[model samples]
Target: MAETLSNLFQQFLLYMQSGGFVMWPLLVLTIILWYAIGYRFHTLKRGSKKSVRVLIRKYLTGKRQKTKGLIDRAIVDAIEAVNGKCDGKRGREIIEDLFFPYYQDLKRYRKVISTIVMVAPLIGLLGTVIGMIETFDSLASMALFTQGGGIAAGISQALFTTQLGLVVAVPGLIMGRMLDNKANMMELELEQIKDILCAEKGLDNEI
Candidate 1:
């Protein structure tokens, strides 16, 4: 498997080299974008397992007779202790205050991902233009006016850059989109819990 992987990487390098200098930077950017996407995905996945629900339940159901203990537990549990206690508005307000920063961070992650997605194609196009220019220049210099040939080589380089760009963008875009959706879902869940808490406190009529 290692040998096969190494061979594949060697082949990819050869292909990239064949595409010419314009493709090099675009390829590098794609690699960086992929790394960022993978990093964020893994980090979020790990954090998601913190069991926010269980902590909330424990805090809510714990004995309230000990006033000091109750407050201490509430403080300790913080967002994790979200029991359905406040009115809808108050609950949402509390939750919003607590999670706004986190939600914004998640949003920022998606923005970075999307920026890479958009930039990759444009970079590829630049590479294509560069490749075409080089090809034309080569033909002019070589005095190949009779054949109307040797055009394919340049075109192949152009296509190669575009193909690599899309290959990088597609998966990054898909994963970024999925990540956004998951973040939204998590936000909504937080909101829903807040709503439930607020309803318990008679704050939100809808709740």
Candidate 2:
């Protein structure tokens, strides 16, 4: 395992060297993109197979069992807000207020993930262009013919950035889309929670 890891690290270093300066920015973008993706994934996780109404019903019955996921926590909090000492606010307003943070959490890092996904491919293309320019410049100076593999190596190295950029982008794009969909679904579920809780007189009524 140690040997395999060392070999992988060596290959990664070589990949960075072959891609030139653009690889650095791509690497940073990859880190930020995945971080944002992971955060959004954690934030949007439902942590339960139960439906929104079922979870709400459970909370309404004062079942204070352990909570999981955004909705679960929000449901528990909303129930507390409604059942707690009245503070001159309607149950609906209180529930909405309680759910506001979860709403923001759902939206967080979404734009950052999307921006990285879109920019990664463009950055890769820039690297490719830069590489091609360098390759041609070397050729112009008769430096290409003196190299072991000459033009082929230059071209290969030039394309590496493009490949890296695409590698960074495609997965981010797919995961970002999935996260966005999950966020939307969670948003709707939050709204439903608000509605279901608000419709109950004291949250003691059945859904």
Which candidate leads in lDDT?
A: 2
- Model 2 scores worst on lDDT over the 10 consecutive residues at 198-207
Error of 2 at 34 (Å): 1.2
Please write out the lDDT profile of model 1 over residues 36-96, one tens digit for every residue: 7776665444232334455444446763232232222332334343444444446556655
lDDT of 2 at 131: 75
Best by TM-score: 2
- The local distance difference test score of each candidate is 0.62, 0.81
Error of 2 at 80 (Å): 0.6
In candidate 2, position 48 carries an lDDT of 74
**lDDT of each residue in 24-105, candidate 2, tens digit only:** 9999999999999989987887867899899878777767777777788888887777778434346676677777889899
